[model samples]
Every structure is written in structure tokens, then in C-alpha cells.
Target chain A: MDFVQENSLAVFGPDGASNPIHVRDTIRKGLWTSHTSGLADGHVQGNVVILPEVLASDFLRFCQRNPKPCPVLAVSEPGQFTLPSLGKGIDIRSDVPLYRIWRHGEMSEEVADIASLWRSDLVTFVLGCSFSFESALIEAGIRLRHVEEGKNVAMFRTNVQTEPAGPFGGPMVVTMRPMPAADVIRAVQVTSRFPNVHGAPVHIGDPAFIGIADLAHPDYGDAVALMPGEIPVFWACGVTPQSAILNAQPAFCITHAPGCMLVTDLLNHQLASF
Target chain B: MDFVQENSLAVFGPDGASNPIHVRDTIRKGLWTSHTSGLADGHVQGNVVILPEVLASDFLRFCQRNPKPCPVLAVSEPGQFTLPSLGKGIDIRSDVPLYRIWRHGEMSEEVADIASLWRSDLVTFVLGCSFSFESALIEAGIRLRHVEEGKNVAMFRTNVQTEPAGPFGGPMVVTMRPMPAADVIRAVQVTSRFPNVHGAPVHIGDPAFIGIADLAHPDYGDAVALMPGEIPVFWACGVTPQSAILNAQPAFCITHAPGCMLVTDLLNHQLASF
Candidate 1:
């Protein structure tokens, strides 16, 4: 593990949820760089996607065409790093704990700060992440195996095709969480309350139905064992844009590193459509 | 056929849409005393429940607890006959084409107008109906077999229990529509967009899962056949509140008779949370 991972885990201990604003404030000043998974409770965490203005419109269309996998929370003005709408003074260039640099859709480097790389032509989009709804599920007493085991949630690339927009065309990527049949319905009802995040399960039951052959081997993230009577519930993942970005092969792009997120001041309840 | 069924069907052509405002206007002027099904096009239709202010608070809790089936669109002030929020000039006392008077939950009489029975302490609740989302499903090109065969959609009294509110507790009732598997997903997605009108589906596939023993037999409305390769889709029905009302056995309550509804000026689009 690197310093980013170590620092993230340090600030994400059991008692790290005192104040999300202060936690984020520390991260922006380079005092912290880590995964944001368990850092803040009840606040909205976002998957960051930064691209050149030239590719911004096409990416926006990609999100619109495939809303389930790419629900947009807030889009920042071109060349502007501050996302006051999502937080008081969230700096997109360095607020996220870690960022992955992509050159022509291929990840080139992972860094704690993007302030040096920030350019006048860059645009930032804060897309809704599963973390928002995961908190809701946990509060509803639905056990999340990944979180319990302290591992990244399991994700897979599915044969399920995404709606094409401009040059952004690729298969949808989904994350899996195992739950009993009865809890599945409750999970649907709870998650449906937060549409800004991935609303409801895109697919449930046998993974083969969605063209996923093996449960033990996930394309990304850590795989947890599925207990008896538990079925894998698949949801449209924020990682979907990564697949789209890879397919579109933009000249330059930046995204939050896996497990690292942009913690916004927006409350999870505020995102509920109801 | 009885006068209500004969008149309701007669008011609508084989393929024509019956406008809600026109139907309400006709009923308000004593021109009709029939069910309002098949009569609203692109308008919000509601299940009417009129109760005295004494029992209104408990009923409100019932609706809030069971939103899927009893989504409250608009609640009227005590003794008020007009719902300014739902329509341009909807008179709760007469906007419905027909109304049923229930004495202690038992059917007393069917009347064209409720003005004669109106009391100063009555409070009206307008609960959303499946018609709103059904229209959406059909518009999305999902074929509804019962509609094609010119029969009322099949509805069943399920063994699934609703969250009990003070004096208002009963089994859930669901409406069924059979469609291909692809359409079932589309139905979920489309209906999920309109939470105000019995949104999405409560149950799908095997009816036995939700404790419905037989598909060909339903407790309310006419039975429709399910063709091979078609799966039954169940939605939270407006009948749920009526069932609760019957369970509570509220004295001197009024509701729209089966197939009869209160049409409002609110457009269906206004109900889409997305």
C-alpha cells in the first residue's frame, strides 16, 4: 500500500466521521490522501471525471443517454476547480484524495494532487456514486458484505450494452452486492429513494442473465464470497464512465482513483427525489 | 351489464381516449353517473377517499406508511370540496363521474353527486392510480394484453400484509399486467419514473412468491389470460386504500366506485420525479 492508501485508512477509522467538512478540509491541504469510503457518513461522495472542454459535450451526452450508470450530481464550469454547489469550497483539482491520470484513455499515473496538471481548458463532472445509497442500505440494517470485510466492493464488466452517444460507446459496468431475496426488495425501495445515485438494481438474481459468467472472478475490485441463500444484486456503477472513457479514448482525462472520492457537503437526504 | 358498466364503456369508443376534464364536466352537470376508467388522456386520475376530520390523521399515517399503493397526490382541507392544487376547478363533491356511499364500510348506494351527503367536517384524499403509469407503459411500446382484449386489468387481493396504521390494516391488493421479459424491465424503468401514480411494480414473475395462489383468478376486476412466454407484472393498486378502508370500517365514508375515479387537471408529466 502507498501513502495515499495509508493516509486514507488512517483518517477513515471508526471515529473518523466527526465532521465531513473538516475531514475534507484536511485533504485539500495535502495533510491527507486516502480512500474516502468510510470517511464521512450521510454525506454525498462523488466519482470524479475531468476532461478537456473538447470532449465534455460528448461525455455529457453519454451520461444523459445512460443515466442509470452515470447519474450526474454536479458539473463544474470549464477551467473552474471550485464546486461551491456541491460543497462550500471544493477544489476539483486537489480536493479528492487521489486521482488517476489518463492519456488517450489509458491510465498513465496515480497522484495525490492534480493542482500542477490543472489547465484552463479542463472541465470537471461530479457523478453520483454508490456510496450515497450504500449508507442508506446500511442504516436500514441491510448488511453490506464488502464493507463488513473492509474490502472494495466487487465490480464487473457486463455484456449489457450502453446507449451510444457521439464516440462514447461501451458495455455498462456494474457493482455487485449480495443479499437475501426479501432484503432485495427492501434494498430496492430504499435505493429508489436516492435517484441521484444509482437508483435501483439494474439486474437481480442469476448473473448469467446479464452475461456475467463467473462470480468469483470480478473484472475489478475485491470479490467477496456469496453466502448461501444470498443472491448477487447488480447495480449500475459509477465506473461505467471509465469504460466509456476507455472506448472514446479521449486525448486527456482525469478520474478519482479507485475507492478515493470527492466528498461533497450535500446531504444524502437532499439527493432523494421525494 | 349494470347501468354503471354499460354507461362507462359507452362513454368511451373502442379506441378513443376519454378526456378527464370533459368527463368531470359532464358528471358535475348531472350528465353522467358512471365509472371513469377508459376516460382520461394524459391527465392524472385519483382514487377518492372522503372521511371526516376525526379519522383523517390516522388515514394520513396509513398513506404515508404505504406510499407505493396509497401515494397521496393532494389532500383537501376539512369540509372543502375544491382541490385547487390538483385541478383548475375540481370539486371533490362532484368531479368524479360516480361515487359510492359506504355506511360503516358497507356499500350504501351509488350516487352521481356527493353534494347532498357532504358534511362540514369531511376531508378528501386523492390517491394516485395505476392508470398514470399504465399509460406510460403502453406509450413506451410495451403491449398490455388485457387492454388489447378490451377487459379490465386483472387485480388480486394478496396475502402480503401492509404496514398497519391505527385502525387501518389489511392485506395488500395488486393489479396485474402480463408482458414479455424485455417489457417487464422496460415497465419497471418507465413506471419507476412516476412514483406519484403507483410507480414501478411491487412484484413480478411467479404470483406465488407474493402469496397469490392462482393467476387466472383474481378477487377484484375481470380475469385476463396470460399467454405463454409472458410474465405477470404486479403493481401496487389504488384498491389498497379501499381495502384498508373496508378493514377499518370507517362509518359514513365515501369512495369512487370500482373503475370510477376523480380526474384532475394536473398533467401526468408533473408527477414524474425525474
Candidate 2:
């Protein structure tokens, strides 16, 4: 099956048939290894960041200092993989379908599971992912073109600088959505309810204002076409932590491969601060 | 004593001890008739509107249709003059310090109390005022120019239209505040906590985009100078409902005089949906 059909079949069916924990379990057992854009309809998906205990405190401070992009959802104790705070049975090592292995801040390869690489000093940090807010946006009746097209949402690195913490410091990375101004307001109101995910847009008008010179040339993800009358709205992205980790260039670090998120049993609606 | 000083003494001091009920009782009496700003810290101050029951349903429909500007905090029973749902011992006829009487859309007079003009056919609507969000802004450490300059907030007519309901139909009216882009984000996050009170900004950046030709020439309230690098942010003002009332040209209506407001027993923080 194609990527779209494969990902679609994993979710998009009946309500109770597929849950977040079940999706994670399927991923853990090597039965599924694909992008999680549309999977686990009503649960929270998290961005994973694992590091040695020595560098964990600095990363914690980094997320605390810059919350818009690096919204920390749950942090695990040293050597522990289960994030009980996020859900009842969440194992950091194998829950996410794909894991990225990095050495000296450079990605070496993507693996199905990190059970072999797990060390006693490894500390896992689950950061809020944009999927939570995207769920909210769709529920508000706002049409997201990327979802319809079955494409990866466009992401870019901007000149906006995040407040630095210890060794973790870098430019803010953001995800872009082309939306009409009217829908933009509704998007802001809807996303603002989910602060655990990236809260409202940081910049709305000209891309140049935030140092993005061209909309067509995105630094990271695939560039999507902007329809006429649709302004580019940017939100701080969880990829920022990944960028920071790459910059920090630690001896060893692990992150969930893009499109392979840690699915938790927590309901998305439960994340609404309101 | 001057108006500000007299009202300030009642709510201000080292302790800042004026409770919402205490402030409402003082306003109900003839002792206080000044603006209720900064009084009863952490309590909600509502925009008052009284109309005959004949127009009550239409106005209620109007508020329902256009929730951003007319967030219904409390709606009184027909002709009851008491809003027990909002607070204890709260009488709409006497709780507000000053009332403006409008006849056929024209301002006829201002009075301390509407007891003499009370009618069983009247209905009271207490709207979530900007004061609640403004308090949130102040608490977030964003400076409001009008509050800092001791002037009324600037308000203007916008080209944007509210969803129409029966006889209540008119262009949206908005309040403006100038702030640096950084503070604008802070302001958005702060005000978003109180959706009942005009919530987040409706527009930002250029005033001309909203059809206002000049920043200094507002349709109502005082115009404060815009400082360097400051952008004018607009919020759906409660005055839109008043303008809608004027358009309908109701035979008789009452509202809190400009600056003067209805002090409620509900704490401002309690109105935060989050």
C-alpha cells in the first residue's frame, strides 16, 4: 500500500477500533513504520528527546526558557522509560515507531526501536507536538491543505531567536500554514486553548518580518503552494528542540524520527487548559 | 474630593481591600458615582445595557450571534432589575454608579440610579467588559497606554460587520492600544484567558486595514500617542452592541455612562476559561 493509504488505514476508520496506545503498540512491535500525521484520532502525540543525565538539566532549562516551541509535556527520571504522567503504559524506548540515533549532534541512522541503545543514564523528555493543535484546528472547521494532500506540513527556520538555556541555543524553527485572515483569527482562538501544544501564531503578516525571505524555499520540510488571498501563518514548532539538540552536539542523543511520534493514551481534549 | 481620588480611596490603599460586593454596595448608594476602573481588584466590571422586553429577545439573539463583542456574563429575568446569578444582593437598577438614558437613539440624560424609570418590561444584560482582560494585561506586566496616561481607551468604528440579528445590525466597533510586537504577543496570550471579555485582538499591525484613516482621530474615547515601533492592536469593543442599539433606534434604553461601569461580585480571574 502507498504511504497515504497505509497511514489512512491505520486511523480513519471506526472510532473505538484504533486508540493511541494500540497505535503505539503496533509501532513498538514493528508492525507499522510510517508518519503519524493522521493516526490515533483523539489522543496526544509527543515529540521525543532522549539524552544522558548530564545534559538533561540544560535541555530542561532550555524548554522552560522558550515555551512557545519547546512545550515540555512529560519528563522521565534517569534510566526510566515509562512516562506515567502522560499515560498509564508509555515506554519511551519503543513506543514511537521510528527513532533517530545521533552522535556528536549528527544523525547517523533511523531505527525501528532503541531497546539495544537504551542506557541507564538516558533521560527521556516528551514535548508537546503540533498534532494536538492541528486536531483543534480541524475541529473548528478550518481546512488544512497539507492534511488533504497527504503531504508533510511545511517547516522553516526563522531569524527569531529562542531564549537560551545552558548549551541548548538556536534559532526558532516554525511550521507554516497558509490560511485566509478570517480563518487565521479562528485558528488563533482555537489553538490558544491548547498551550501544551504550540499556542497561537507568533507571526502572521510578511514572511520577511520574521526573516523568512521566500515562502517557496523552506529550510526543512516540503514547501507547499500558498493560494491567493491566503497569508502565511507561522507557529513555533517542536522541531526547535531537535534543532537545539543538533546545535548542542552532545556525545549521544536520541529523538523520534520525523512522522514517528510517541502516541499516549491521554485524550486531546484533556490537554485543553480551558 | 475629585472623582478619581474619591473612587480610588474606596478600592485603593496598601491592602487594596474593596471586594466586588462592597464596591457594588457603595455604587448603589449615592456616595459613589465615578468610574469603576481599578476598583474591586480581581473582580469583573460589566458593560450594562437595559432595554424593554419587546427588544430583549432580539438583543439576546444579537449577543448570541456576535459573541466576541457581547459575551453574555449575566442576563436578568424580565423586569427583575436583580442579577442574582452574577452576584449576591446585586440590583441592576442601582448597582451601576451612573446610567445614560437614550431616547429614540439620542442621549437624553445621565442619572445616578434608574429606580424612578424602572419598568417590569425591562431586561438587563451585563456583558463581559474589556476591563477583565485589561486587568489580565496589567497583571502580565504589559502597560496599557490609556491607563498609564489616565485617559479613556481609544475606540473607533470599523469596516468589519457583526452577524446581524433582527433590529440589531451595525458595523463592528473596536478599541485600540499601541504596543511593541513583543507586548502584542504577551497581550494576546493574556487576554485569551478571558474569552467573555472581548478575548484576543480582532486586528493588529495597520489601522488602515480596518478602515480607520487616522490613528489620532478615534470616533470615541481619548486618543493616546503611538510611540516608536508600536503597532495598534484592536479588540472587539462592547460599544458595538451600543451602536447596534442606536441603529435600531429603540424608544428607550439605558447603559453605563462612558468610563463608569457595573462592578460585579464575580472575580475577574474567575472569568478565565482556562
Candidate 3:
């Protein structure tokens, strides 16, 4: 675990971690180089995707065709690092805790910042993540297994194909959560309010119906125990776009590192459609 | 099927059946004596329970404690047969299409009009029914199997117990609807908006978890087919309060017959909490 200096922590009080701007400032200064999971409670953290202007139009069309998996929260113009709509002084190059550099569908390196690699024709897309809805579920008294076990949510590449745009199209990716039967209904209601963050689940109950062969052997992330009376609920994941992008194999692209997201000024509750 | 006279139908146009006042007036004239399903399409229909003033307080408390199963829509004062709050000049004695007279738990007779049995001490209670939510679900494009087959919804007595008040205590009764995995999520969201009408489902997935052994053998109502790739979703039924009242064995009581209900002026969309 990465630790912040005691003197810096004193400036924002004990609950400074809950402040989105403060958390972004810490990342800007290179003091926080890890995942932004627990930091900035109640604020929206987005999945970052930066691609060249040439591929931006095609990728935007792909996201439009598949809004459930790749809901666009904000998009920055080519060569512009600032996303004014999401927050103040949001530098797409440095605000994200860590960045993954991709070369022709393959990740080549991970770095603290992409400032040196920034290009004049690069456009940044900020997509909604499931963290916001997970917070709402927890507040509604629904306990999530992955959060309890402190593990990455189990994600799977399903047989359901995404609507294609140019070279970006692949099987949809989904995050699974095991919950009690009663909580499953509440989870649906709670998550339905956040349409920008995948909204309600695409499929529930039977995993085989969605082409998932085994619960224990997930395509990505660590698998958690599915208790005796619990049923697995699935949501369209932000990782879906990453999968589509990788399949397209663009010459040069960048995305936030797994678990490391771009913290935004938007409140989680503000995303509720109701 | 009982048909309205052609002359009477002409007076209200082709959509006379969708008008609540016309439906009630037809019931008042003894022109319709069967179940009230499919009549007054966009209006709210309620499960009627009439008891002596001595038992009204206890029954009210039972509904308050177990709101999801017995959501109280309106309650009439002692000796009051009219429910002005529900509609104009709505008389409880003859508004329902059919009524069952219960004596010490066992129903003695089914009658179209209860004018002869009206007592000054009788108090009427109108509880929200699932018909309101079902209308909302269908409008959202989720196909219901029982509705498609034109059969009564399958109901069962679950091991799950309702909160007790006075002599009212018994196992909860649930209405089961088998829908495709995707519709199940939409059903949860659609029904959640109408908390007055059973709200969200109580249990989903395995029936044995809720103590039901066979889907083919329902305790009440007609059993519908559960197709492949579809999962059974359970919602608390309006029959729950009736079951509780039967277990209590009130010396004298009256309730709307199985499918017959009290049609009200309240529009179905008005019940949405959102």
C-alpha cells in the first residue's frame, strides 16, 4: 500500500481521502501511484481511453452502438488534455493514477504519467465505471462479495457480441457478483438508477445461458465464492471497451491501468436517473 | 364470457371496458358477475377486505407491519359503504364484481351483491394488488406467460412468514412469474416504482429456498409453464392478507372473490413512486 505524507494528510483532515480534488492532486504530484478504489468516497471514478484523432470517430461510433458496456461520461478534443465537463483542471495525461501504453492491441508498458507520450492528435474518452453503482448497493444494505473479500470482481468474455463499428467489435465483457436471492432484486433496483454506469444487469441467474462454462474459471480477475443460497448477477463492465479496443489492435492507444481510474468531480448519487 | 348489451356498449364507445366508472356501474346493475381482469385497463384495482369495526384496528396494524404483502390503499370508517377517496359515489357493497362471504375462515357463499348483508359496524379495507405493477411491466415490453395464455397467475404458500398483528399470523403467499433472464431485471425495476403494489420481488431463482417443492402443483391459481432459459421470480401476493385472515378464523368476514376486484379511479401510472 502506498502511503501519503503525515504533513500532507494533516492539511485535508482525517477524511481528506474522500475529497476527489485532493485525491487527484496527490496523483498529480506522484504521491499516489496505486489504484484509486477507496479514495474519494461518493465521487465518480472513470475508465480512461485515449486514442489518436484518426481512430476517435470509429471508437465513438462503437461506444454509441454499445452504450451499456461503454457509456461515455465525457470526451476531450484532440490534443486537449483537459476535460472541463468532468472536473476542474482534469489533465487526461496526468490525472489518472497510472496509465497503460498499448502498441497494436498489446500492452507494452505501465507508467505513472503519459505527459511525455501525449500527442497533438490524441482524444481522451472518460467512460463510467461500476464503482458508483456498487456504492449505491452497499448503501442499500446489499453486501457485495468482491468488496468483502477485497478482490477484483470476476469478469468474463461472454458469447453476446457487441454491435461493430469499423475495427472495434468483440464479445461483451461482464463483471459478476454473487448475492443472496433477496438482495438480487434490490441490486437490480439500486443499479437501475445509474444508467451511465451500465444501468441494470444484462443477464442474471444461469451463467451457462450467457456462455460462461464455469464459475471458478473466470476469464479475468480473481474468482470469489458463490454461497449455497446465492445467485450470480452480471453487469456490463467498463473492461468491455478495453477488450474491443484490444481486438481492433490500433497502432497506438492508452488506457488507465487496471483498478486505477481517473477520479472525477461528479458525485455518485448525481448519476441516479430518478 | 359475459357480454355487455350492444346498446350499453354504444353509449360508452368501443373502449367502455377501460372506463372505471362504467365498469363499476355495470357491476352495480349485476350485468358483470365474473372476474374483473382485463377491465378498466389503466386504472388501479384493489383486493377488498370487509370486517367488523372491532377487528379493523388489528387488521390495519397487520398491513402496516407487513407492507410489502398487504399495502393499504384505503380504509373506510365503520358503517361507511362509500369510498369517496377512491372515486365518486363508490359503494363498497355492490362495486366489486363478486364477493365471498366467509364464516369462521370457511367461505360460505359467493354473491354478486352484498346489500342484504351490509352492517353498520362493517369497515372496508382496500389493499394494493399486483395488477397495477403487471400493467406497468407489460407496457415496458416484458411478456408475461400467464397473461399470454389467458390463465390465472400461479400462486403458492411459502414458508416465509408475515409479521403478525393480533390474530393475523400465517405463511406468506407469493405469485410466481417465469420470465427470461433479461426481463427479470426489468421486472424488478418496473415493479419497484410501485411499492403500493407489492413493490419488488421477494425471492428469485430456486423455489426450494422459499420452501416450494413443485412448480406444477401451485397452492392456488393456475400453474403456467416455465420455459427454458427462463427463471422463476416471486412477488408477495395480495392473497397473503386473506391467508392470514383465514388462519385467524374471524367469526364473519367478506372478501373479493379470487379474480374479482374493486376498480378505482386512480390511474396506474399515478402509483409510480419515481
Leading candidate by TM-score: 1
Local error of candidate 3 at residue A1 (angstroms): 16
Local distance difference test, per candidate? 0.81, 0.82, 0.85
The TM-score values for the models, in the order shown, are 0.54, 0.52, 0.51
Candidate 2 colliding pairs: B42-B268
Per-residue lDDT tens digits for candidate 3, residues B119-228, read 99898889999899999999999999888987778999999998776688899999999999999999988987887799889989999999999999999888988889
| All DockQ scores | 0.02, 0.01, 0.01
Residue pairs whose backbone atoms clash in candidate 3: none
- Rank list by lDDT: 3, 2, 1
Candidate 2 accuracy as TM-score: 0.52
TM-score of chain A of each: 0.93, 0.93, 0.94
| Per-residue lDDT of B166 in model 1 | 60
Model 2 RMSD to the real structure? Answer: 20.4
